[model samples]
Target chain A: MTRFMDVHHGMEGITADQLAQAHQADLAIEHEENVHFEAAWADPESGTVYCLSEAPSAEAVQRIHERAGHKPDEVHPVPLQV
Target chain B: MTRFMDVHHGMEGITADQLAQAHQADLAIEHEENVHFEAAWADPESGTVYCLSEAPSAEAVQRIHERAGHKPDEVHPVPLQV
Candidate 1:
């Protein structure tokens, strides 16, 4: 599996509850894509959210997020980690 | 405490060993700034490195990276998390 970091923009003013819900949305169906969204963090003031996950590929992560109703602006593959 | 995602560029072709060393450098001195670098991931092809940390502030993260000899190109504050 490869680690991925995805970013989403234009969610300004997102609250903690909202962020958790969005993350849970992805988690609920992530298994179908063989992806695990480990965690999500956001700068509510800037509406920028970052998600770290382990997936077969970036596309899998993207598809999961899209189906969860919060598509990412970019999905970066992070194959090398420490 | 806040979660910060910092990015570093221009280290193309970085190897796993090199990445670990770089991350260790930050970990070695993170406590001085009350920062804990949780993990680091990189894409050698893109030379993009992302550092995840819990810090008192974004500035503290930047300072730690700078002191550790891999100053970041960007440090984003992620105050809301899930």
Candidate 2:
């Protein structure tokens, strides 16, 4: 599995709890797509949401997000970690 | 310029102010390398830090981080934004 980081924008004013709820919604169906969301971070002020996950491909990550009703603005492969 | 997101780990218990200071330190030298750091997000509990920037290459991003004293575990190009 490869690590991926996806971004969601236009989420200005989103609360942490709301983001968590969305994450939970994703988690509820992620397994069907072979994706596992590991963590999420949100900057309510910037309206940006970031999610880290392990998935077979970026497409799988996007699919999971799409099903959860929040398509990512970008999905990039995390090639390194320290 | 392409947008990139980089992650730093093992930052457990770091405060938002500290991260901002580190980010400021990076900004202090970013111009020398033609990198522009746009935003940063930190999850203190998870020891995770994410930075968004515009740079010529991921290597440039790493160089900035290296100079600022914190090397990212991974730097990925942000290919899309919505």
Candidate 3:
């Protein structure tokens, strides 16, 4: 599986609780798409959200997010892991 | 210019102060390469570091990281912001 990181913006003032909820939403449907939502981070001040996952493809990552109702602004493959 | 998010791993015991120092190192050379290191987040327990930046290309981002002496595991373009 390829690893990917997706970003979301304009989420300023978002609370950790809300992010956890969104993460759960992604987790609920991840299996169907062969994607695994691993972890997420949010910067309330910047309104940015980042989600990390291992999936078959970047498209799968996007699809999972779309299904979760929080489509990503961008998706990029993670080539290196240190 | 495009925005990008880069991830660094295997930093489980990294401290916030270390991250700040790394960030400063990047900032010190950002202008020469047309890369702007915006913000960074570190999860001490997970050993993960995320950096946000605006750069001319993904390579430029990588170059900045390399100069800072903390190469990223991956770099991905950020295409959407909402």
Q: What is the interface RMSD of each candidate, in Å?
A: 1.1, 12.0, 10.9
- Model 3 scores a C-alpha lDDT of 0.81
How far off is residue A2 in model 2, in Å? 0.3
Candidate 2 Cα errors over 4 Å, as ranges = B1-82
Q: DockQ of each candidate's interface versus the true one?
A: 0.81, 0.06, 0.06
Return the top candidate by TM-score: 1
Residue B16, model 3: lDDT of 59
| lDDT tens readout by residue for model 2, A1-82 | 9877777889887875788789889999999989999877665655777788899999999999999999999786654342
**lDDT of each residue in B1-82, candidate 2, tens digit only:** 8878788889888875688789889999999989999877665655777788899989999999999999999787654332
**Cα lDDT of model 1 by residue, B1-82, tens digit:** 9889888889899899999999899889999999999988898887889888999998999999999999999888888877
CA lDDT, candidate 2, residue B36? 96
Candidate 1 accuracy as lDDT? 0.91
Note the Cα lDDT for every prediction shown. Answer: 0.91, 0.82, 0.81
Cα lDDT for residue B45, model 2? 56
Residue pairs in clash, model 1: none
Positional deviation of residue B46's Cα in model 1 after best superposition, in angstroms:
1.8
User: What's the residue-level lDDT of B33 in candidate 2?
Assistant: 86
lDDT for each residue of candidate 3 in A1-82, tens digit (9 for 90 to 100) = 9877777889888886788889989989999989998877676766778887899998999988998999999776654333
